[model samples]
Each structure stands twice: as C-alpha cells, then as structure tokens.
Target: MTAVHYWRCFCGILMREVLRFVHQRERFLSALVRPLLWLFIFGAGFRQVLGVSITPPYETYILYEVYITPGLVAMIQLFNGMQSSLSMVYDREMGSMRTLLVSPLPRWYLLLCRLLAGVAVSIVQVYVFLAIAWAWGIEMPPLGYLAVLPALVVSGLMLGALGLLLSSAIKQLENFAGVMNFVIFPLFFTSTALYPLWRLRDASPLLADICALNPFTHAVELIRFALYLDFNTTALAAVAAATAVFLAAAFYGYDPARGFTRGKQTA
Candidate 1:
C-alpha cells in the first residue's frame, strides 16, 4: 500500500470540501464577519466593562481584547470547524457524504484530510483576524505569529473531529445553531479563553473545575501557551486526549454497518 500512500486521495477530499464552501460567497462573507464583530465591536465594548487581571503566562495586566485574542481565534475555529460539519449533515441528507466514504482508500486518512482542510480554512480566518488585529493596534511578537500555526492546526483537528462526531450524531442540519449555543459557547465562555481558570476558581471553584475539564479550554490554553513560547503540559495532555476521543468517535460514526454509510452517493 506504500504505492498508494503517494496518492493524496485525502488531499482531493480536502479540496472538494474547500470548493464546496468557497462557491458560496455569502457563506464566505458571513464567516468573516462573525469573528470580526466579536473582536472589534463586542470585545472592544467589553474591554471597557471587563477587567481581565494577569494570570499564569501573563506577566502583567493586558487589555481585555489582547487577553481574549487567543480565545477569539479559538472561537472562530470552533464555529468554522462546525460550519463544514453542518454542511456534512446537509450533504448526508442530500446523499453526498456517502460519495466520499466509498473511495478505495483508508477511511481514517480521508477523514483526517477533511479535518486538516477545515483547520487550514480556520487558519485563513485566524490570519485575517490577525491582520485586522494589527490594523487595530493589537500586534504581537512576530514569533507568536509564526508559532501559532501549529497550534491552529492542532486546535482545528480537535474541533474538526468534534464536527465529524457531531454530524454523525445530530444527523440533521437543523438544530446546529442550537448546538452552538448550548455546547460550543458554554465551552468557550466557561474556559480560560475569556478569563484564566484560576480567576474563575476565585469566582467559583466548581465552575473553574468544569472549565478545566473542557477540551476547548485546553485548546485555548495550548494556543495561549504556544503564543508566549511557553509549554503547558496540562493543555497538551488535555488536547491529546480530546483529539483521540473525537477521532475515535468520528471513525465509529463513519462505519458503514453503523449506518454512517458504506457506498458512494448515486447521482
């Protein structure tokens, strides 16, 4: 099968998913707007009202906008990660996800490619946000910009696998926004993305513990640690475990016998 390894069937899967979304200009513009609104409009107003104190890996007090930049970036990936999954649910309903499933290749690679492609797309949004942040005077060290790529990819995979698992479970495009409200937002808000876990603990021990348990918290922590050129073992461990779980769940969902589907979509 080494001969086949040279072939990037998965890359083709990646491109297809990109093209599928890119063809819709409205979707593209909407995706861009969601994060900018959160960053520029909402975060700025909140920065005045909100007081984010210094936490671990942070040496001094910083603006709320700067403190939450990583989280905001994470938030974009979290939603964008799900966007394509929403598409997957729609495609499954329209009998399209099945077409990609039946290819004569390893199933895991195909899914990985899809996840990576989504991550790549998420990276694009992050850079766009970074550019906007720069224009707004939210610049960081150039190294942080360079280091954030791997974190973006890893964070994307974690969330993308999450999307895959969710697509299989929800089985419908409707109610996705509800899923975001109930699941994704809770994960983001409760995490150290907005405020550090220690600060949350000071406010409430139980809530802090819950945020500590969240994988997205770890994803944010991972990026936060990486951005500062620091290593967070807990964040790394948490992300690794979460990615494994989501990937396992996703593969199980794609099992043909399990009704995820076995054959290609019939045109």
Candidate 2:
C-alpha cells in the first residue's frame, strides 16, 4: 500500500478504537474507578503504615499514594491493553478479523496499527487518572507531566504487545479469561507497583529478584522516574527490549503461515 493508504488505514483503526471506548462509558468508568480506589482507599489506609524513604525521583518523603501513582497509571494501561485484545478475540469470532487480515496492508502493519490504537486509548485513560490524582493532591514536578508522556507511550506499547501476543495464542473468548488472569495478576502483583524492591526483599529475597526480572517492573519504574522528570536508563532499556520481543512474538503468532489462523479455522 502507498504511504497515504497506510496512514488512512491506521487512522481508521485508531478511530474505531476511540469510538468504541466512547460508546462504552462503563469501560472508562471502571478503568478510572479501579485505580482511584487503589489510590484513595488502599493508599490512604496504607499511608500511616508505610513509610517511604527519600529516593532518587523523590526529593523527600512521599505518601503511599504518591509513590504508587505511576503504578496505578501502568495498571490502567495494562487492563486497557487486555480489553483491546478481548475486542480482537470478539472480532475474530464475528469474522471481522478475517476481513481486516485480507486487506492489502501487511499483516504485521495491520496488527501494529491496532496496537497503536489500543495504546492511544490507554494513554488517554492514564492522563485522565493523572488529572484526578492531581485534584486529590498528588503533587509532582510540573514538567514531569510532559516528561512522562514518552514513558507512558513506551509502557503502554509494551503491555499492549503482551495482550496481542496472548490474543493470538488464545483461540476462544472463553479461554481468554483464564489466560488474562494468569498473565495480568502475576505481572502486576510481582512488579514494583505496590511495594518497593526493598520491601519485597524484606518479605522474600527470591520474590524480589523475580520482581526485578519482570518487564512490567521496568515499565513501572520508567513511568515512576519520568513522573519526577528523571531518567532511568535501565528501566528504559528493559522496557524497549521487552516491547521488541513481545511485538515480534505477536507478529509471528498472527502470521498466516504460522498456524495461528489455521488453528482458528479448524477450531
């Protein structure tokens, strides 16, 4: 396809995702509610119990809510990513995916387009969450908002790619719930999302090491640092590498000759 045609296709897919999000007010509300509850209820309850020492991105002591804000942002992206994948599975069942696959555009390009669309939707949700956090007195450097944009995009893509990979492997919507539970809960709970590495280490050194190795941990760290207008080279590198690997796997899984489509047909 020509560059113009490719651009048009990308915009159309993105718009469709956006429109779907708009129509599903419950989805948006649920996404916002999950993190807000974590921030207000859980964070408030933990505020007196958990004491955060001064860290790099933070100049002084911070509240539990402030510390986990980035993680909550990542959580929004994680769920939205899986929701996008769920839509893809539904599309496949309804035969719309076959029509999309038959387009003149390369399959990988089409998949990437869908991934970007999902990321776009997630980012919007993140910003909305941030605004609400701000209203709730969660303060950060003013420029941190601008600096965190790239980190949010990178993190969103990494999580969204994982969803794509899962969707390709899952043949039916019924099976996807189990797969999502298997993937999402582990990735989120094991990461530095809820507690610092030191805290996890205090609990279990082995668990801390596993958390350190998780790409979602790096994604959260990336956002955490960016939220303070700081650079985290290691986190950035880890997330970049994970995104590449996940996207490659998703592309291969969606390839016509790779048995993904054939298996779906037989099923």
Whole-model lDDT values for every prediction: 0.81, 0.93
Write down the TM-score of every candidate.
0.91, 0.97
Write the residue-wise lDDT of candidate 1 on 39-131 in tens digits.
788878888887877776677788888888888889888988888788878888886766777676677777777788788888887898888
**Clash totals, every prediction:** 0, 0
User: Candidate 1 — worst ten consecutive residues by lDDT sum?
Assistant: 258-267
Off by over 4 Å in 1: 1-6, 261-267
Tens-digit per-residue lDDT, 89-142, candidate 2: 889988898888989999999999999999999999999999999999997789
Highest lDDT among the candidates is held by which one? 2
C-alpha RMSD for every candidate: 2.8, 1.1
As a whole number from 0 to 100, the lDDT of residue 252 in candidate 1 is 87
For candidate 2, which ten residues in a row score worst on lDDT? 258-267
- Candidate 2 CA-lDDT value: 0.93
